[model samples]
Target: MMTKLGPLLLVLLLAGPESSCGDNPRYEKFLRQHYDNPKSSFSGKYCDSIMAKRGLTKPECKEVNTFIHETKNNIKAVCEEGGEPYGNLRRSKEHMKVTTCKLKGGSTRPPCKYKENSSPRYIVIGCENGWPVHYDESQIVTTVDNADLD
Candidate 1:
């Protein structure tokens, strides 16, 4: 019995920490981390202040990240009927403005300097029960005619 249960436990363990049973706490954390919009306009200080204030660079620097300039309701619509299924993620039908922040080379560790660039993009995200659980990536919609757009 113990031997049989061992494999079952292993499979469950291999599934990792994410469970789509309910509203995941990670979804809220994702919102907090990646969903801020510029009030006036994005500035040179945007990434620096936002990242540090949001605690992404506290213990160590995050390698890369993006912030979407839209409300949660708009982002939530990506998982609805309009979203295209791309593997385990849903791709947004509408384009959104996003700012990509990359860690600057040779920057001090604690200070974790970043360079930012903003662009229009369609986002891919993982959703369960119509709520976003993961931010996949921002995509440039080059193929408006292509059905396989991801």
Candidate 2:
């Protein structure tokens, strides 16, 4: 589970040392929604909207952008090969190349055909216009999960 940031942090970033009325409740609500689901781009948009409405000066928009960029980099780094293959997936209509990933607690050499008998852990990164239209995996699943061969 993701740990949530508190309203105190939001207020500190926005209003500073002043506790005023008229907008405190709204600010608290916005902070709660944002911290609860920072991964949602729609939530980011909502935050931008709130900032516009409040006419308050806060780094909410900038924070959202930075958060997204950093998270993407972390995901890319998970599959990097000597920092060369950063898993920079690109949006495509068709699936791209299948490069073998270094499996967990396993041999460093490329997975053999016999070893490619199970589902590989992968993260779908590239999104076409904010929607994931395609995916390229390091390996493919041979056995179907919960398969209904009827």
Candidate 3:
């Protein structure tokens, strides 16, 4: 079942300062564009619908983008607790579900095309004012020891 953003979720996403860790405009944008907690099921055309629904295809198709599937709180915990800081980017301590979107054949035209890859990997988020501002990167989680995955 595809969960469209609306109703109570809209209020939560568009909440005021009284909300929890995600209280800023950048955090809202990040949630709208990248964070998909109850994400859509993966398919060959996943990127096209998902990105359009998330508003990433608006001012021209984004070259590449990644969607993270995890609770907002868990994503924040990466920065607050076990995350390692590398300047403005912080790497998540746990491997997460993510789908990366890339432009197909280098096309930038309307009805933008994309290819997707879904896997377990560690993600990085840009932190600003203690909120996740944007997705920075994700590295494949090697099959090493759990504690040594980093």
Candidate 4:
């Protein structure tokens, strides 16, 4: 009985420390040291004075705020056509082709065109044209797999 009890006690002692590790004590300590613990930079001079007063650092607040702002921007851009924070225009999935577009006077690299992949494959559009106009089946949106797009 004594021998069996000794093994059980050792196992319990070893497992106890591992269970506490799941709390991410290392990460928590790091966060407290840099962002939350004593003399937090967010205090008084920053936007969230209460949090700051409680010892949140300026960098910590800034990181969280920036992440929120970026997430909002991404959501907006993914759904809408204009005023995206990243300034990338939303494009249609069809009715456009990648072709060499030439400038009226100067030479430009191959440009995207409003044309179908078959039957007169290339139809040039003005550089300032925002999006391609639909004319025929040839004017199909270039397909990209989600993984490739990413």
Which residue runs of candidate 4 sit more than 4 Å off their true CA positions?
Answer: 1-19, 22-26, 30-47, 57-150
TM-score of each: 0.72, 0.17, 0.74, 0.16
Candidate 1 residue 23 Cα shift, in angstroms, is 5.0
The better candidate by TM-score, 1 or 4, is: 1
Cand. 2 Cα-lDDT:
0.30
Best by lDDT: 3
> Model 4 over residues 1-150: C-alpha lDDT tens digits?
999899999988987641332344443432232222122243333323433343433333321210011222222222344222112333332222222111122322222111111211222111122221121222223454376457
Of the pair 2 and 4, which is ahead by TM-score? 2
Per-residue lDDT of model 2, residues 98-132, tens digit only: 22212233332322111111122333333323222
* lDDT, residue 74, candidate 2: 35
Candidate 1's displacement at residue 81, Å, is 2.4
Query: TM-score of predicted model 4?
Result: 0.16
Ranking by TM-score: 3, 1, 2, 4
Q: What C-alpha lDDT do the candidate models reach, one value each?
A: 0.74, 0.30, 0.76, 0.28
RMSD of model 1 against the true structure? 11.0
Worst ten in a row by lDDT for model 2: 61-70
Residues 41-138 of candidate 1 have per-residue lDDT tens digits of 43558787778877889788876778888767777778887577877788787787887778888644677888887887788888877887788654
Error of 2 at 20 (Å): 40
